[model samples]
Target: MTQSMFRRHFRTPGTESSSAVRPLRASAAAGPATETIASYLNKRLAEIGVRYVMAIPGDYISDWVETLDDPEVNAGLVRVHPNNEMCATYAADGFGRAGGGKTVGCVSTTYGVGALNAVQAVAGAYVEHVPLVLVNGSPSVAQFNSQRDQGVLWHHMFDGSLTDLRIYEQITRMAIRIDNPALAPDLIDAALTACITDSRPVYIEIANTLEGYAVAPVSGRAKLKKSPIPQNTLSLDEAMSMVLPILVDSKRLVVLGGVEVARFGIQDRFRQMLKVLKAPFLSSLLGKSILSEYDTPYFSGTYNGRNSQQNVQDLVNAADVILSLGVQETDFNFSGVASADFNPLQPPGLPLQGSIEVRMGAARINAGLTLQDQGELYWGDIQLEAFVGLLQEVVCEPSGPAMQSLVSQFPALAPVQAALQAANGQLPNAPFPGLSGDIWSIPKLTPEQYRDQITWDSFKSLLHHNYLTSFGNDENQDAPVLLADTGLTFYNLNNVKVPQNGFIAQLAWGAIGYSPAASYGVKLAQMALGSRRRVISVSGDGAFSQSSNAIGTIAALGLDNVVFVMANGVFAIEQFLINAQAFNPQSKTAFAPFTRVPETSLWQWVKLAEGFGGVGYEVTTNAELADVLEKIKAGPPQPAQPNGPCSGSPAPGCCTFAPDATPDVRPSTFTLVAVRNVCNDLPSNTRWKLG
Candidate 1:
């Protein structure tokens, strides 16, 4: 990428070091010097670290089309792809998760279609709190009120005046539309600022006409300062009054809205508090993996866990006082929304007035509600720092018995134990060399074990991405990055556990297929941060194939980490749909296609990844799969060669596993007794143990 494609870093007044800023003399220059808005915009983009923006050309953004396509202005700074807005935003969001810090800008022509298409991914970023900047090329500023009358009726143009009204109110943290060309630079600066501020999504609408309009040279004066942590603005006395009481009096309290954990850089503090209070902790989906460093049994709350859904809901509903930090009640995070919409008067199997109603017990807690100063039930002003001063002053018992007690007493080991026993069913009853013990042992290893067996060491945390980094001496080492997609992989992360630095999908936007392209971004960010950390991304079968084309980009880059595809071949989350349909006969929602996946067809993905010069493998069963993972991990670091066949591509005979590879080994009565004993030993103060 060339320097002119992105914004340049601005130096403050009196610190100017570049001779390029020397005033241009009218007499010395031949005629009037001129530049188009596209040139200027691309120039600014290159100034910052942004080199590539993923986008598909649209009618409204023709200015950028004319600009980026210009061989002269966009040389090195811009690249375009022929894909939809979802893929483009997914790529950008993936880049941000890789620790780019700077929001990767995404562009689209304006309308309900473009914005709505991007919304699912953008909403993923919003919910996951991933930093993304979306720039919509508005219809010409001159045509805003007149376009409908010009008889320039086109498919993309609207009869109504052009405004990004749908998204203007729905998803972004801050949004702006520029009617004047002069303000374009400021709008760009502000949009970037808002994206990094609070790590949220922001939107900017630029008129297509603004592209070629000339303006004075940028003064370099328009830049944004970081937003102060919201908690800092709260009065110390008020926070003390509000939070200390809850902490001191409540026996079952736990923190929610784990965003504050990042804001205060206080995962350590959180660990300390959890130890002191001996309270169980539950994080909103955004807060999943918030404290990767600690493997406290307190980590999973009832609602967030696959098994503990009902228990967690009950715990939250019954708590005398629930203390939240930086948590807000958004519709997606709130569980109160009805999953079913059945008509009460209609009989079973009869056509109901509305959708048939069936409610999942998990959807009851509204994380969005706020505790106001006046005690009113409202939402706003949710920040963790407000009570930091009071929090710092409260001394906790360092070695509380509560921690040990919770570890001992909470005994729902049945499900996990059952899963362990079921592993034997997966393996063949053969004399396998390493296939020696209970089936549960197969998946028992923590995420760190997976990392250790493979020599690559990058980890990206969902919250800060850099949490697992080394100290000062090794600070320059590249981020060892791994990207995880949404599914059981991320949601069940608290149980499986991983090193702190691993980045998981936390996109507030909740869009799928994000990890694949975002893996490229993670590699780019690691490079920019001057770290040599290897980048790996793991995706489910559905998401991996959704944006499968990114496989070519990965091979083109030859980034460090292996892209592992866990091919279950179904959208697992949609099971709720099948469940609702099965339970409620009157319900009309059809079950998504889960049964028709060609099991043999999965190997094609390996071939695709290999075709892109990435090492790909099809590990159908446990035999030697661990060894393959180890070899990929130990290989020398090199960017993927686009055309080179992946060294790890599954070969004939090397890829076969017996039909009954995994064998079910039931847990003995002795093991169950032991587990129960461990649970019973926990202290009474532990959140899992009731009086």
Candidate 2:
């Protein structure tokens, strides 16, 4: 196809006039003879800087897997084998997040069951704006054509139709089934570009027969390019005109950064903007760690409506003008119980006149001109970076004396600033006995300080203290931490300090067992980026059991990430709510017995971890955990290289973690620190009502 024709065919919708359609980089051109479609796909992935492809092999995709196995065709891409398709996809998502969109994550799965299993992960990626390339192997072209013509059933077919592709379409930016090998390169290139430009997952279904199909190599200049950042000068000027006047007039201004700032790779730019604006700033829950809280002077704290600290809430609520960047108005973002009149899209109410929201490709301004009509201005297709850049420029122009005078009219942000300063002091540092704060108030608790038996609160307190004492400092600034599940485990860890871009949690989706599977991918991505930070995963017993099989992947791959399982012997979050809402005074019955589980009789996670080819430790008190932490600290360092099957040997079978006659031996060591806790015990601040 001609260059112009190719560009026209693949240009993303709504970006027709965007400057993102520059000519392909010189490195993308073809080299010599034509290559097989599979080889070309791998080359394209490498060219686009994808370092790994998380995968799970199956019958339909065996041919493609073999092609990837070929040393000549594999390029520099490493194929990672997760225990299941779900873990594979989650790993890809984690990789994308950690790489900060510079390196796209890829996952390969067989058609039907394999592809279907990855749908949940893909959906989460979609919602979170994570860029991922999902490649699925389907029936051969001949088989597919025959099925289309005569309804022949394939081995993995569900409903005797191509349902896999249909299912992914809803959760991906682009979904294409390659029926013709000749168009394979073009299709893959288009999907990859979309994945990058939109920051969402894209699905590509390659027919098994097409792996070896020969096609003309793409020329060096015929590469896929990300859509240019649109200027949108007129829209930007219009929006800024409406916003700056109000901003200049306001006395109290606050900047609220959200997940989009991180997703769009604009953390640095956002930080610069905050510095230039010189306003107190806070982050939404998802936006935490977009910038380091410890370093930013004006960073008040995180805000979640009623759930926020009284000081944080007062600071945000009292702002006369608020500039929110890339914030999504989710139920959880607003603490799930914000006032009915609370409109995150606009200012909370009245005198707080000017509110500005800059989204991925949209901008909104509320001038608060009238009670009935607040003179809200909306503009679409405006790049968030460009809008913010222009806004910063306009706000910081040479004619700033008037703006400075207006800002000086307001009282110093002392109340909010003092509160933040106090909170900052409470933040744990290298020293063990850091001053206590609202949530982390207890002085570094030791196992010896507690009674013989460990309760949920004591265990949680000990874990929090250990994490702070171990990694919460400038020296360990880049340590990676993962929080699995959405109950007390997440709640406790959320309050802990994490390095910038080092925390991973499915908080928005609240998916169970996400952390265990996702931690594997996070560690892989960390290694790919040449980081030596030890990965730490925290999970409740219920959530850990859901994806505990992933421990095998860790052991088989020789990854040394640490996982802490809070063995609470129940779905504590569910039971907490049930007890609160369904208590029967007469019958003295709380809820069904199913809410609880036998502690020792249930799956022994410590033994399970041992079976998975990793070391296991059961800690019942703070002292025991302290000993475990010291051992971990003194343990052998992670290998400078990956020693898993992907390095050389054949990949092991699934369920390698299961018990066997002869115990499986592995090179790597993973530790399962099982903290025993009481079933009904919960943190004091945990509320049980739904919003």
Evaluated with lDDT, which candidate comes out highest?
2
Which digits, one per residue and each the tens of the lDDT, describe model 1 over residues 561-656?
Answer: 456665554454344323434223355645466622344254565455555555455553332345444454455334443222333455655544
Lowest lDDT block of 10, candidate 2: 427-436
Q: Per-residue lDDT for 509-538 in model 2, tens only?
A: 777677877787778877877777677788
Q: What does the lDDT come to for candidate 1?
A: 0.45
Local distance difference test, per candidate? Answer: 0.45, 0.66
Q: Count the backbone clashes (under 3 Å) in each candidate.
A: 79, 9
Segments in model 2 whose C-alpha atoms lie over 4 Å from true places:
1-30, 339-355, 366-374, 399-443, 446-449, 452-461, 469-478, 576-594, 597-600, 635-666, 688-691
lDDT of 2 at 679: 54
Q: What would the TM-score be for candidate 2 when compared with the true structure?
A: 0.80
